[model samples]
Target: YKSGQKCVKVIVPENASIDVYGSGWVCNSGFKKSSTSCVPMTPQEIQKQKELEKALAAEIQRRRAQGVSGDDCETEYKTNAEVCVEITGGDLDCNESYGGDYYRDCDATLRYEVSTDYSGGAYLDVDVECSIEIEYKGRETYSTQTDSSSQDESHSLYAHGSDSETMNFNFSFSSYKEITSVKISSAQCEIDSVDLY
Candidate 1:
């Protein structure tokens, strides 16, 4: 029965009957009840909980120093090749019987160069593109037939094409951690080296 409630019913069993009403129960000598729950914590238990909290705080601080954040950095590579071939035929071919050696042939080597730069820890994405422009004897040639026999290829950060082509790419990372280094595969182009700021 509660402190202020009434016990309105009573029945005694033939075999056993025990009834205690209007009485308060006390806890053991060294135990105490708080609200509706029991709690027992020795000094060791309390010390262990404090130690766990301190270790958690230290781990969080370490992560912050490692530059964990919502920002990200990205990198990409691009390549291109421009080839020009100049063939000089010094005679108007009239007949094979014309005994005059007046034909000259000259060839110039083509060069391909690739360069890259990055913004340290500030890069959200990257874009790469390559273009080829052919100039013969100080004249711009827009015809693709001029270099039809030439073959070019690229093996970059994202391998795209061959034979003097343009490729565009974009990349994203998880955090704004500074870029450490960039590596390029062995290729047949002049690499100007990557720069980071």
Candidate 2:
């Protein structure tokens, strides 16, 4: 009796063929062996991968040419870029409280002057916040408020060729409590955008 009939059948992997000696399996002509399986990688597939890499590189180069960072601006405008505008002056006007040391019905006007470096013309969206502190009967109270100079929600100011603009904020204290003193504790400005024309 021949033992050949008792030999176990070898299972061939997909996309692969049995070796000439019938001892193992090898990947087909157009496929490559990956671990225990065959993966197809024709000449056309290699060409497509190369094309995709080239296109991605071209996109990065185009954005660099336009002065745009890979992503949007990450920091405040004035700190990240050259400061094209500055607060030249600040004036406060207020009405005296009736028979008290405090003043009410106040208006704070901030003036901005554009630098000569950007004389071409620009639109700026600036946000200003000021902290007001008041003392009443030996206790101090603080408050912060915001106002936009632009017609829209964004506080935009358009300046052309070394121009300047003023922003006004109204502050009124209606409480009948007797206040001792009213003063502006701190003030800060954050420039959102500066678009040059």
Candidate 3:
């Protein structure tokens, strides 16, 4: 009996001699000794740990590429409405609304409507009046008009009765290489809507 020694004893047959060295204890099959306990590391468990470490490394690299620091990362995204709206309307119409002239070759129609409501009498006719100016683009080879002359070229519309009246005007010029813009001036009436194709 060895006292005050942390040694393990094994009893074999009486005639058998056992060899014991000082290089720790021998572990049984499928087990390993770690400190005072026998632990095992399965192949599946080792593979899972490696995969987790790889995934963590990949995530860290991704965040680093986006200039993220610490534990927080920022990302930007465009809204669906903005993305959809951009697909339809593109570029601003550069034609001056009140100053310059616009030219169009296609059959362009400027429609004007005036409506009035009389509060005092049901049979009374309310009078409404308005005006609009259509400017046509000129050729570079020809001389352009001054501001005063350009105002003279604008088309005007006048209305009498209040109920409702529609006026259509057509001007013939060189086919419009491009559609510019249309300007409206309203008095005693509101502009309902405008359309250009």
Which lDDT value does model 3 have at 51?
67
lDDT of 1 by residue, 1-197 (tens): 33357644443323223322323222232222232222343477456545644664574466458864211222333222221111111101111111212111112222332322322342212222222222122113233221111333333321222122222112221122212221111112222232221
lDDT of 3 at 100: 30
Candidate that scores best on TM-score: 2
lDDT of each: 0.26, 0.47, 0.29
Give Cα distance to truth, residue 70, candidate 2, Å. 27
In model 1, pairs of residues that clash are 152-163
TM-score of each: 0.19, 0.38, 0.23
Candidate 3 error regions (>4 Å): 1-117, 141-165, 174-197
Candidate 1 global lDDT: 0.26
Number of backbone collisions per candidate: 1, 0, 7
Full ranking by TM-score: 2, 3, 1
Tens digits of lDDT, candidate 2, 6-110: 767667889998854566666675565555677776698456545644654575477568874322232234424333344444544445555435554555555
Better of 1 and 2 by lDDT: 2
